[model samples]
Target: MTYFVKYLPVTTGNSTRLYTDGRDYCADLYEDLRSAKKFVFLTGLHFMAEFGLIRTGKPSDAVATLAQVLRQTGERGVQVFLLVNQFWRDESEVITGGHPIRAKIMKAGELYGYLPETLKLFDSLKGLKNVHCRTDIHPNSDIFATHHQKTVVIDDRVAFLGGIDLTYLDGDRWDTSEHTARHRHVDRTQKFWHDVHLRLQGPAVEFVRDNFLQRWNHGSLHTIRKKSLNSYEAWSQHIGEDPRHVAVEATQDRRPPALPPFAQKSVLSYTYPADGEEPAAPTVQIVRSMPRKDNWHRQKPTWNTNRSDEWEHSCKEAYLIGIRSANKYIYLENQWVADEDIWAELAAAARRNKNNPDFRIILMVPYEGLFAAGLGSNQELFIGTEMEDVIKASRSPATFGMYALHQHDRRSNVQGQIYIHSKVLIIDDAWSLIGSANAGGISLEGVRSGRDEPDTELSAIIHDKAFASAFRSKVWSEHLGVPVGPTYDVHDADRFRGLANKPGGKLRFFPGYDNIKRGVPTWFPESLQESRDPLRIDFAKQSRIIPSLSRDLLASGLPPTLVRAAFTARVVPSVPPGWRCWYRWHCQLHYDPTEPSGRDPRRAPVYLKLRSLKYDRDEVWNYSDQDSVYIGKLSAERINAETTTAVLGVIRCRVKILPLDEGPNDPGPSMVLQFECMFLNDRFARGNHPDFVRR
Candidate 1:
């Protein structure tokens, strides 16, 4: 018989062998490792070196704890295996931007040499006699694709999984007490992040154990084998070479039932046919897509393409089934909300009143783009463009409102708008999904244009009501700014009644819905619409000319005052002949080549010239490679020097350019380009595009 185990706090009937906040969770993990004797397997998105625990002065408590556990386990002669995402290799950098508090931590770490030391710790563990730690990177995409599953198994008897990444922030909670308020960073007044984690025993432990082992074996530098006591000549003299050997303490006689490595284990010892098993063990499948094939985890054997249907079946499909299965409400919190299909489904569900008409669908997303204020160009432009399209397409004209959450600082009046870093889904208080995958084609379909095929993403479909209810409640509480309590019923009749009577209803517009409905502008100043005729001159030329003027102004002087003035001026440039023609033909182009170009030439290059007309535009807009306006595409063969010189001279003599708009709302010098593309009949038809009409 196969058994299913679900661990969630406040869920009915679910086991609670492990329960703790972030601090206790880490402490307990350390305790579990210290007591383990046989084997240890660990995997996480990040495992930083010793650093003080958040809100506490215990220096590098998490790291120190893990190191102690490793040392103790090694002393007992246990074989320990660890796998962490290679993305963590660069400890000095922040994974996502927008948080000044985190930025300060990163800066301090750099100053204190924390990054190098962290790398050294991993190196030391890898060099240990009995410990093996490996880092893996996925091939599907760069930082965008990561091995985000967090799991740990000790002696193949205990395991954990959830949204918790191995980091200090995940473990810290607000003190709530006034005594700790004086500590600038340790204020207990604010709530710590809210999340869920599960601990499992029985056969499920083996599944997690195997996952870590597979990742370790696949990514480790050294080869390892399961040492059977009977096969070891030295151990044979001691225990007659039994497959199960005592590395330190004697083996316990209380063995639960033994099954093949791949076989599922349950309370009752029942063997199914090698090729067949009924009601597949309530197994939580582990899936990951990495950049490097040799990172750490052993890759599963490729499915035989001979059976195409079977191969397709084995591949994880997008969460269409989960979305469709939602009965009461759909609660979502994700890093980004740009997937059109997902938004469509939500709208359909809301309109159909699939659950009670009062049914609620709440989405928690970062108020601003994560990449808005960082090293990379503002990715928000592209994401915002997509978001706008989705919202526009899904708006019920009935009743539906999307709200955003942001973090705020009461002291300085600075709000750190809530950045929806968590990827979670709760459906009708029945199912919950927590994983690394985002809401995009690369995550959902797995297929990226230039790649061979879409790979697998890991996610667990939890059916435990306790887990779902708890998750939904916490998510809703945070989104609605309510205390964590069971005050609202997701399926309450009054809720549905209230939603249906609204202007559009719960599926229709709320007061502030317009703000969420509109996508981030492709161009700044709202008044300056996108122009396909690059030469089209406008009075507010601020958006069109400021980006160029800002660049020139920056190069002109290094003085802080001058730089400030230049940025504030919002001075842009008049469209050059070529730029004007390109924009007219393509709709959008980057004004600066050095700036981040949201468009991939392979995917969209038509708006390359728009780069020259930069403003507070979204980053995603770009021209396609097939666009006729692209200068690179036009010049298949380079023109001779004589032809270039003649063309340059004629253009220089014909047009005299000047700066455009300079105003307060000019959005400063660091302008981004945003583009919009219209597709008709399954194909991108440029002539009929709405953006072109404005030009």
Candidate 2:
């Protein structure tokens, strides 16, 4: 009943190079883009038109910018494609007066300049005939969902994917490896940024390329124009273009680019001790958090869809699996660690390591995030408290260390704290996972009704000793100011503890981190936090509701034991063919304790109701119309955990459908499925330590 599914297989014969900061990433990406011959693909939350692809003494020079490279590349008929995240909220939140969320939006805009930059970037590529541009909007954008993947595939032979976006909003994303803050500046004050990226080649590149094509072929150039951005309507409407059509039409006949022959290449951007053993090309597996529903039919296989394509959350699965599999030490460096499930797993790991004195769990994150006044800082404090509570509740003996990164001058004057934008996890110097997906609910949790959906994400897990060891050593050396020798053990937990305690480098104890016992702050309400940093949907409540339903069936002259079996015996209706459907839909099913069932004195019957729905790609529907379908109520039964057979009474299931019309090159009808059954793999219901769910 667990929702965890191993979606992607481990791919071998892949060469990888890791980048710690923006300067190296920019330099390497620039060189690769210049070498691109067949096609160039890029996707991200924000792709600024003025973002410099290469660092120069004069940042104002247009020659080093991405727009310039894309222009030149398109002119050479290289077929450049870009998919950037653009949302309706970005416009309404900024321009709409008296909007409910305008204050928060304005605060964000004040910190990071709010510009119609997605449009700006698209317009910059206007004159280039071969350069194609599109905007990827989340289906639930009205509820604040947005695309968050930062990835690039060049010529279908090489790929770069990670947390760093090609934008200069908060600061120049192209900072040096040193992360100096003394003189670096773009528009406002300089910010020290610490992030990680991966350059991959071999069979693994195919996954990244396919991901780009899937999104590009299905996404649009812009949302159908509504109010503002009159310039947007003028530009897109005048052309009357379908970007998906344009991209697919362009690449339909092109032969798949053959994977280049394997070569022994260095995967490190820095010189580090490798125990005198050449690291083999890593065996890499690509994982992602993709949306469940789209406007058109998809070709990729999803976890739940039998022959159909739908949502996939392999990225979250990979994180939980990697943490559970850690044997010696766990190293996590992410921009945000706000998800309770992730923190719960860390707590469980600590308890598992309680008997081993050498066991350590280390976390490195930003001292202060982009919006400190919002959920970011509050979540940091809440996480520290959660971890502290677990340590007490479980009485774990594992050495736990939480630290942040900052820059300082010779006189030890605080220059700036480095924004830890890296999403990295190294386990026992043998396994590593890196990508753009943060350790936050928005990036890891699956979709839910009346709640935010997970961000679309792309990441890779590498199972290579050499690669993981080199990465840990290189990063730990910079933070601890200690040079690693050829024989130094990266996995020795004691060595790290000693070095971290005597840190003279960037590593500092996280601000406001304490061992005091406290719940989430009264000031930072969980409801507000859920709106911003939401948690995973709880589907295990079916266990409680089903039993109540069974009691009601008993009062209606149905035998107690047979009541549970009857539900499963009645076959559930299958999703109809000719409809490309989402495996699950959003429905509101609440049990009101005050309103008891008339059949049973102690039980309450669950009622199903509809919420706001979208029937077409652009229109919102408040009530069901001709375009919608309401399948009759069905019974979903509980199963024995091990036997996988029905063992409990029926849980009433509701299926609500929002049907969408086919596109120009239609494969079939697109349907939104909202059904209630049971998700057995709910971790919270699996009897995890009570402190995990405790305040």
Candidate 3:
């Protein structure tokens, strides 16, 4: 059996570098294109004409129109192969009441012609030599599947791979990972684009090049409508019929050319261009998910290679193996995640290492997507929910945590949205992959019902610890402002958990945008204290096992039971102020081996009950936490008024401590709730508010 359906052996003696974000990445690519002597292979899901270069924060950032640069490159005799997915958003298999809408989209696809209306900015480069273009349906994939790989190989010596798009006339993706609002830079608007891309040099480049040729040999040629072309490009141009332009009539009833036989043979090395230099890299492996099929209806699977009737889908295989082999940690960043098989693999990994409390998984996904109604967004949300449930239901819920990147406006430190669109996975800082394969059913065998095939995907994997460690630190520096260190250094799990619970810090944890609106806690880490925890109340999960005698007794004559015998509404008992009411509670527990009731090793219970004056809601003894029980200077003003679905009046709440279990027929007595400090009274003012679902 063939081990690699479409994988090449690890390419050695190659150097690789990482680009932190979109700004400099885009700029640097433009510069590389300018210096290319032989060929530039570019492929993506979509295209944007005006989507050109940006002004990176660096002094060397170049400012140029990407289309113009491409034209000049072609004029300079550099081969440019540009392949994009079918120029239309796919239709759903099951149609409902929205027939007209689907029909309109299909019409739009046709009206846009072959290359573009297709895309708003793709028509301007119709006439250039050594510059070729095509629209692909990923011949072997489901008709609904897209050619979703993003790669740029320059002269076969260097390659760029990641989850970035070039479909903007305006430079919306120019900021660093810092992601701040801009005044007037590349375009009139500024967009927060948090993405990752890689620069690969060496044998892996050969494999990436093969992937491109396989598609080009089997893809379709696109012809644009003459009318739309003329309308959009009426410059100092020709007055009559244009040979370079083809109308729908000229292209009507046309069939894509059949693929020539080139068996699934892959090239691990190629002749360097006349002016080429050796690709420098220590080692890298090329892995991709491509189905080997007879696109031309030939009797054999491929022409050039002996291997036939076999397919290559090494991306999913690599991902599963990486996750299963992960002993310490697994870090993942993708636009969307919806693969059940991958989730199962992760769950199994967590179960195996029950002894290692630090063995964990961390994920970063976009807060939300632009295509909320699309299948991608729907599946992503579904998977995220299921993943959280699986972790919470497991023996140890703290084994997994997910986060989202947040970028406050550059000028004013106000919270803003930052989109995470990189498809990457790193395991134990020993193995990593960077490319266009997301953990989605669509990406992994699209329409798992088998009615449709998976989307075409590509990724490069490396087993170099030095490279992986360096890459991890580079990413951490961008996201957490951590200093670039020599070894692969990530935040300690304990320290990370501690920092999350604190209030403010430069690299504070962020709950995914969806979770935050749903009233979830941010950075549930019980330590660091937000860089401003003046009174360091330990919030670490380990803090639960502290001594229990701290709550023994007080010299003052106060109530001994957990609940206050009687409580008042306001500071003054005589005056019931309708505005705000405060409830304060405190506790520090200690256990003695000498005592009978406090001998249990587990944590004690801190219970809470909430009620409204209008009898709108009521709850008794809700478990808030175990170790220590406390409610700050909690008051009516602190909670959001209009946002919550509860009753429309001041809320009344209570705190209770359950009796500790002791010897037979002897339960330890409960104690009164204490107030140590006052919680600052302020209104909750987040932009989006979701109704809290009562469990």
Which candidate number has the best lDDT?
Answer: 2
Per residue, candidate 1 scores C-alpha lDDT tens digits across 1-695 of 11111111111222323222244456556777777877777776556543222334455444454555576577677777666554233322232222222333333222122223334446555545677655555454222344656777777667766555554332222122111222223231232343445666654354455555444445322221222434443433333333212221112122222222444334233222122222222223333333324322234422111222211111122244456565566667665454456666765666556335545666554433333211111223233333333344443322234444433345544322333455567666655566555554334433333322232344444545566666655544434434454434633312322332122111211112322344321122223335434345442322321101122322434211110111111112334323321111223321222322111223323222222123423221232111111122112112221121101100000112222433222322222222221111111111211111111
Worst 10 residues of 1 by lDDT: 645-654
Off by over 4 Å in 3: 1-8, 56-63, 89-121, 138-144, 169-171, 183-191, 226-282, 291-311, 369-376, 388-397, 410-415, 484-490, 493-695
TM per candidate comes to: 0.54, 0.63, 0.61
Q: What 10-residue stretch in candidate 3 is worst by lDDT?
A: 686-695
2 against 3, candidate with superior lDDT: 2
Residue-level error in angstroms, candidate 2, position 596: 32
Q: What's the ranking of the predictions by lDDT, best on top?
A: 2, 3, 1
**For candidate 1, what is the lDDT?**
0.37
Model 1 lDDT, residue 139, Cα: 51
State the C-alpha lDDT per candidate: 0.37, 0.54, 0.49
> Once model 2 is optimally superposed onto the true structure by TM-score, how far is the C-alpha of residue 37 displaced, in angstroms?
0.7
Q: What is the lDDT of residue 253 in candidate 2?
A: 16
- Residues 14-53, model 3: lDDT tens digits: 7787776676778778889999998888888766565547
lDDT of 3 at 135: 65
